[model samples]
Target: MDYPYPKTERQAELIALADALAGPIAARAATVDREGVFPYQNFRELHAAGYLGITIPRTLGGLGADVLEYALAHERIARACGSTALAANMHCSLIGRIDETGMWPAELLERVNRDIVANGALLNSANSEPDLGSPSREGLPSTTAERTPRGWLINGRKRWASLAPALTHMLVLATVVDGDSPPRRGNFLVPASSPGVRVEATWDNLGMRGTASDDVIFTGVEVPRDALVPIDGSATPGDGLGWSAFGGAAVFLGIGQAARDAAVHYALERKPNGMAGPIAELQTIQHRIAAIELDLLQARTLLYTTAEWWVARPAERGANMWRLAAAKYVVTNAVIRATDEALRVAGSAGLALTSPLQRYFRDARTAIGQPPLEDVALTTIGKAALGLSPGGNRDGAANHDAAVPVATVRSV
Candidate 1:
C-alpha cells in the first residue's frame, strides 16, 4: 500500500518528518532489538525534529495535528522500526489523551507541555498489574493512593508499562483511600523522578525489545492532590481508546507490510537449481505475495478509515467504539496471518535471526496480547448486533466536547 494522504498541510509535514526519520530509525532497529534496550537515540532525533509533541495543539506549544495525522505518522514509523514506533506510540497516545482531558490543573498541564516542547519529556500509562492482569476488563488496581497532608502517597507495581525507562510522567491508576466511602478509582499524575519510583529490568521478551516495557514500581510516591485527574469528560474517550487500539493496528500492519516486502525482495533474488530462475517465476510464490497484499490492503483501509471517522464525527464516538475495537481485532489478526504467509514464502531464509522477516514475525505476534483483546472485541460486536448495547457512557455525554482548547492553557 500506497495511501493517498490527506490534502492538509499538517499531514504533509508529518509524512515528511516520518520519511526523514525512517532511515536512521531503520538503521538502528536491529541493534536496539538485539540489545533489548531503550531507543534513546531514536527519541532524541524525534525530539530534535519536533515530533515528540506532534499531537499537542499549536497554541499549547505543539503541532496541533489531529488523531488521523498521528495514526499516519505511526504507520510510517512502524514500517521502518516496529519497536521504536511502539515506544513512540505510547508517548504520543499519552500526550494526546492527557491534552484532550481537561481534568489536569492549568499550571501542571502547561508545565508538561513545556517539557515536551523543549526537552522531549515522554509519558505513558502504567495500568497493567501482575495479579489483576489487564485493567481493561474491570479489575481493581493493586496500586493505592493514600491521602497525605502534603498530597497523596502512591504505592504499587505496574507491569508492562511501555516506555518505562524514559517516561517523564506516569498516569498511574489507583484506588483512592479516604476512610468511609468505597474506594474510588482515579489516576494520579506521578513524575518519574519522584522518590521511590523505580524501574525494574524485566522487559526481556520475544519481541519489541526496544520498548523497554519494564515493570515500574511506585513505593510511597507522593504527588499533589491536584494531580488526581478524573478520566471522564476530560479525555476524548473514543479518540483516546482509538489511539491505543488503532495505533497498535497500524504498527503491526506496518510490520506485516515490511515482512511482505522483504519476502518479495528475497524471492526475486534467490533462484533454485530445479529448472527456472528466481522463485518469482513460480505461481506458488506469486499467489503468496498476492495473498499478503490482499490482507494488508484490507487491514490498512479499515485502520485509516476509522481514524478519519473518529476525527470527523466526534459526537458519535460513543457509538463507534464497538467498530473501532472490531477494527483493531480485524487488522491485527490479518497482520499476524500475513506475516506468517511471508515467512512461509521465504522459507529457511526468513527464519534467520539476522533476517528482518524473523523480527517482523516476532513483533507481529506481540499485538495479539494487547488490550481490547480479540475475544472481548468480538463479544462487543456480537452484543451490538443482538441489540444489547455495549457498556460505557464515557463518550455519550454532550459535555465531552465542552473542554476548553488547551492552546489557551485553560485551567480546570
Candidate 2:
C-alpha cells in the first residue's frame, strides 16, 4: 500500500485539534518559559487531547495518526509554545519508535503511557553524553552497560537531556559487554524512580527555558531484562525514524510561521511616521514581508516534500538525516530573520522583555544549536550528497573514544 504522509482529512483534523489545544495555553506556556519552569499543566492538557500517544498503535488507546499528520500537529504545537512543543515532540517521537518495536513491556508501556496521558509523564531519550556528544552514530558509548547476574548495570552521564524534569521514563542507550561478537549497543527503559538514576534539573539555557533540559546521572542503575527495548532486529518503517524526521521539520515550520504571524500582526498595528500610513503599508516593510513569505513557502515545501519522499519509498528515506537538518536550519534561520526584521520594523519597543518578539528571538536562536546543529548538519549533508563517507561528525574523536576499546580494558 502507498504511504500517505498527510492525507487532507488527517491534516484538517490535526489543525483543528492543535488550534484548540494550543490556542488558550499559548500565553500560559510562554509564561512558563519566562519563569524558567516546566509547562506541566499545558502538556497534561495536550495529553488529554490525545497528543501524547497520537502516533501509537490504536490498540494502545492512541490516535495512531500518520507521519505527515503527526508533523502537522507538531508544527501547531510549536507555534504556540516552543518549549512545550519541543518537549512533547521528543516523547511523541520516542513512543512512536517504541510502538514500532511491538515488544511493548506490557505493564511498563501501559504505566508510561498512562502517566503521559493522565499524569503528564514525559518520556525522553538519553543519547548525548557529556564526554562524547550525540551517540546516534557508530561512536563507542562511554556509558557502559555491564552485564551482571542481575540484569544490566548502567553507569553514565547524559547531558542536554531535554524535558528531564517532567520525564517519568527514559530510554537510555548504552553499550553492552559480551563474550561474543562485539559489545552490543542498545536502549533500555529506565523509570525515574529506578535506583541510581537522578536528574540534575539545572538547565539554565538562553532559550527554551521551559524545556527544563538538564543533566541526568546514572549510578549503578539496574534494569531487568524486560526493561530493555531491543532495537537490534527491529526492521519496520517506524523503526527507522520515519515519523521523527518529519515531526521535527513540522515543529520548526510552526516556529517559523509563528514569527511570520507576529510580523504580520505588528505591521498593521505599529504605525511609524511614514509617508502615508502604517509601517505595514510602507513599501520597505511590504518588500521584507514578501521575502518572509517566500522563505516560509520554500521551507514548508522542503519539509512537506521530504515527508512525501519518505512515504513513497520509506526504505530509501535516508535523505532525511540531512534534509530534515536542512529544513530545521532553513526554518529557524528564516524565523530568526523574520523576528529580527519585525523587531527592526517595530523599533525600540520590540526589544523589550514585555514583547513576545524578544522572547521568540531568544527561543529561535536555541534551536540552531540543538541536536541538528547547522554546521555539523551541512557538513554531513555535503559529504552524503557528494558520495563521500561521513564516518562521524565533529565529534569523531569523542565517538572514537566511546566506541573503541581502551587499553585499560583487557579482553574478558
Point to the candidate with the largest lDDT.
1
Q: What is the clash count of model 1?
A: 2
TM-score, predicted candidate 2 vs. hidden true structure: 0.84
lDDT (Cα, tens digit) per residue for candidate 1, span 1-412: 7566655887888888888988899999888888898999999999999888887879888877787888787778998999999888877766777677656678888899889999999888788788966576656888999998988999999888888888888888888997686897778888999999999989988989889888989988989988897654544445355556666677887888888899899889988889579998889999999999999998888888888888888877765467677777888889898899999888998898788888999999998777667787787766555545552334342232222211110000
Model-by-model lDDT, in order? Answer: 0.79, 0.69
Pairs with backbone N, CA or C atoms under 3 Å apart (clashes), candidate 2: 140-402, 140-403
Global CA lDDT computed for model 1: 0.79
**Model 1 stretches with alpha carbons more than 4 Å out:** 234-239, 391-412
Estimate the lDDT of model 2: 0.69
